[model samples]
Target: MKLIDHTPQSLADYTTAQVANLVPDGRHQALREAIGRHQDEALARTIACIDKVAAWRPGEFNYLHSSQYCQYLYYLANTIWVREKDAASATRLFLLNKALNGIDLFYEIAMPAHFFIGHSVGIVLAKATYGDYLVLYQNSTVGRHIDKIPTVGEGVIIYPNSAVIGASVVGDGCVVSQGARIVDRQVPPRSMAFTAPGGELALRPAPEDLLREYFRL
Candidate 1:
């Protein structure tokens, strides 16, 4: 079924009906409940983020209706709602993500606005902080070590089956290669971190120079 056929020019052009149709059929009520939890400012921010993502991917109409990105939108909205002290709504969205995406993401985790979850399944983000435009793939883990946690920067992409743990700092525009393990280290901006044969991480310039052209840097 076609959920969203046209892209709105702005958030003001988006109607509740359109949003309702975009969400999964059985999840409409939950989406409404979660949106209802947002106050004026948080609601505005959430709407803006939705609009921004839609505008960012204008050609991909399915992106709006995809369960993966939809769950991300809900999580982003819940983060704003929780910051505004709307605990009930936050908890509901968190549970909804777990139920729909099958991932464990705590509501207290700091997921900033404009962050992107490429694929939601098997992803864990228990980091200290996440910057804007972050992209997380499936089967990736961003955990912590003891009391210290990883701090990710803007436009960072963590590929599938990769893990970034411990007091690590990932700079802006850094790409963690698939299956790489980064712990207790720092990655420079616009660099790529990949695992060597001996399981040691090697840092080099990002393979694709056009990454900034595709992602927000």
Candidate 2:
């Protein structure tokens, strides 16, 4: 799917089809074509970032691995190239924009076949290993440091301002406290993770009963 091979007008039409499930607008096709014709030069840096991240994964080649990471970068690059104001890089962007306003789906990122989000903003997800029903609040980060990947279990609630870094596994039904920081550790299920003194981490019953509030059906 080389985008440059097609005419700018045709590329716009194709982009509309690709994102129609998220944003359905008859004029979006024309808008996309105009952006391609006018903004191709401006989107070069983002395109480079996408290409760089696409080939740098450590996992084996398979649908689960590639679709979750590599293909995401491809879609992200093209989406941002077409829409320059937003920083969203996946499906979450579309849903978020749809929720924020009645406007078309804008910028977002989300894994395929993942849990639903009623609303989202300011969320950052890294290339960490994740299980089902992973709910995240705004400003949460699942990231790495010194060549380590985080492993997140099912039904985890990462609250706002929380960060889970380095190699760690947050077990099922856990709640990471708002403004909490995690690094290089394994957390038990149904537990509460919070930040302790000296930037360390501690566990206790989640304040406000976060697990029951966010994870329970």
Candidate 3:
């Protein structure tokens, strides 16, 4: 007997109105307000971000999966607008993110665009500065240790059940391996942090050698 695949078509085939329907009702009002506040060109840029995320999959698309990217888009836009002191619009998106994404990400957290939150459940991001293209998986944390917060660089991948805590600086092209813990240490760029023989943390140079398959290069 042959099995059949029942996956939905790619979201790239849908219209803007159809894509917008995937967002929750509560978020729609806030999204419209946020888009309205921006100029026409800026609005187009924001839509482009949404489209980019929507078209990520190679073939079939699922609304349940793609909707998370929409949540990320709102959260990123909210962070940018909040930095410009648009309190009302920012609050709306913040509330929407909390309600939809189930992540305890504060509005003060400086997460720029192109940051992906995979499995948003159990992920906590404090008031830390995040560079572009940061990918965070479930059960991973980025928070303060004492008075200092982490400064994460671009293209840093924090895998599941891992963390970068305190005033640590995670350099570009670094991968925090799953179940690894990095606290208050500067991880050099293009390196990998993993568990040593005695369960201690060790950094391996040139993570791309081992971790290239896990992240987008």
Give one digit per residue, the lDDT tens place, for model 1 in 23-88. 445544554544544433444444444444533543233435444345444554555555666554
TM-score rank order: 1, 3, 2
Task: Please report, in order, the local distance difference test score of every candidate based on alpha carbons.
Answer: 0.65, 0.54, 0.62
TM-score, structure 2 vs. true: 0.48
RMSD of each: 6.1, 13.1, 7.4
The window of 10 residues in a row where model 2 has the poorest summed lDDT is 59-68
| Candidate 3 structure quality by residue, lDDT tens digits, 19-107 | 25554444445445444444233334343334344234422223455344444435445554754666654555455555566667765
Question: For model 1, what is the C-alpha lDDT against the true structure?
Answer: 0.65
The superposed Cα distance between candidate 3 and the true structure at residue 100, in angstroms, equals: 1.9
Q: What ranges in model 2 sit over 4 Å off?
A: 1-119, 197-199, 205-217
Off by over 4 Å in 1: 1-34, 37-64, 67-84, 208-210, 213-217
Pairs clashing within candidate 3: none
Name the runs in model 3 displaced over 4 angstroms: 1-35, 39-80, 209-217
Q: Model 3, residue 121: displacement in angstroms? A: 1.1
TM-score: the better of candidates 2 and 3: 3
Q: Under the 3 Å rule for N, CA and C atoms, how many clashes does model 2 have?
A: 5
TM-scores for every candidate against the unseen true structure: 0.71, 0.48, 0.68
The superposed Cα distance between candidate 1 and the true structure at residue 19, in angstroms, equals 17
For residues 39-98, could you state the per-residue lDDT of candidate 2 as single tens digits?
444234333322323232322222223222233233444356356543333343344233
